[model samples]
Target: MRPKLVLFGDSITEASFSDGGWGASLAHLFARKADVILRGYSGYNTRWAVKILDKAMAGIGGDAESPAAVTVFFGANDASLPDQRCGFQHVPLEEYRENLRSIHAYFKKKWPSAAVIFIAPPPIDEEARIKYPSGQAERTNEAAGKFAKACIAVAKELSTPVIDTWSKMQEIPNWRKSTLSDGLHFTTLGNKVLFYQVVNILIDLGLSEEKLPADLPYFYEVDPNDPSKTFG
Candidate 1:
């Protein structure tokens, strides 16, 4: 069986299979080489993720090799303003950090051989968020940055790789407009950026298509005149 690659996170991750989404891009890039599994929950925070981690991971890696890789992307909702409409999703900064640590620890305990990667929350655009239908002004770029830092710090302590989406996106010119669709969610361009970053890291971790063996015989090797030669 092909190895698995898991994506675990909140809303952004939930929508990652949409057309032109980063998760979909990863799935396509790893086709025939690995299985990309998504376990995203919309409007969830670290607090909630911790509650369901075991169940979410249940049945995975059973009687087979553990996932080759797993990406944990959360924090956007956790950074929500505690007094705002989305306050229910807010998690204290310190607790947020601890939650990340707990998550990494859990994964390592369950799948010590799996390569775990954390994805820091992307920068938020307050204006765009205000313009969004919810218009609750629930999050701010500054808060997101703080959460991102906490995420990176956790990754450092755990000695795991991380994709600093917050800083990376901001480095791009006009990222607010070009990368985000409603300040928080990614636009197609944003997806493209994340896709490349993810692919690059996976390559570095030796999970690239070139490095992984395809699951079945290559099409070219199949003899049309005598199918059993390759099959049998």
Candidate 2:
């Protein structure tokens, strides 16, 4: 039987803008190799993600030996400031770290043998802050990077693997300009790039096989006025 992999995350993971966001692309890439379940929600933080995972595993009676692999991505909403536009508040770095530790402990207890991969959120476009005028975009960006580092540290403590999407994103000079049109969320190409990067990381960790397709499918475009088309 193929391994069951669960992707639990936020908007980026939820693919709020397009149909085949990175998670869908990952599912396709790992088709037949594993059963990939996309369990992501928009505007969720680590605190909520832990609850969601608890709800997901409520009735699944499998222990560590028969546990499922879980990949977690958060910190986007957690780093946001308290504003009506963003509809989320900033969580302190220490609080965020505690939440992450809780999540790590939860999965470790439920699925001791299952591999857990922590994925850090991508960098935000400082220029995009002009649209919403957060003024704290740079600070938020720094905090997000710190959150990723915290996750890596937690994973190290737990002996789990981590996929540093943040660092990988930083290496791309045009990532912000080309990947994000609004300084948040990814364009089609951006999601594709993330998909491949994630798949490669999973392969390197021996959690997944390297069977990615050469040419991945793009999201279908329709009316320009439709926000769903632009975001989902």
TM-score (all chains, Cα) for each model: 0.94, 0.77
Error of 1 at 94 (Å): 0.7
lDDT tens digits, residues 1-232, model 1?
8989999999999999999999999899888788999999999999999999989988877535789888999999999999888889999999999999988888888888888999999999998777455666789999999999999999988889999999999988899999999999999989988888888889999988898999898889899999999988
- For candidate 2, write residues 59-100 as lDDT tens digits: 554783344577888887787755535545566667778888
Cα-based lDDT for every prediction: 0.91, 0.70
Q: Which candidate is the best by TM-score?
A: 1
For model 2, the superposed segments whose C-alpha errors exceed 4 Å read: 16-20, 58-61, 64-68, 82-87, 132-139, 210-232
Error of 1 at 117 (Å): 0.5
The deviation in Å at residue 82 for candidate 1 is 1.0
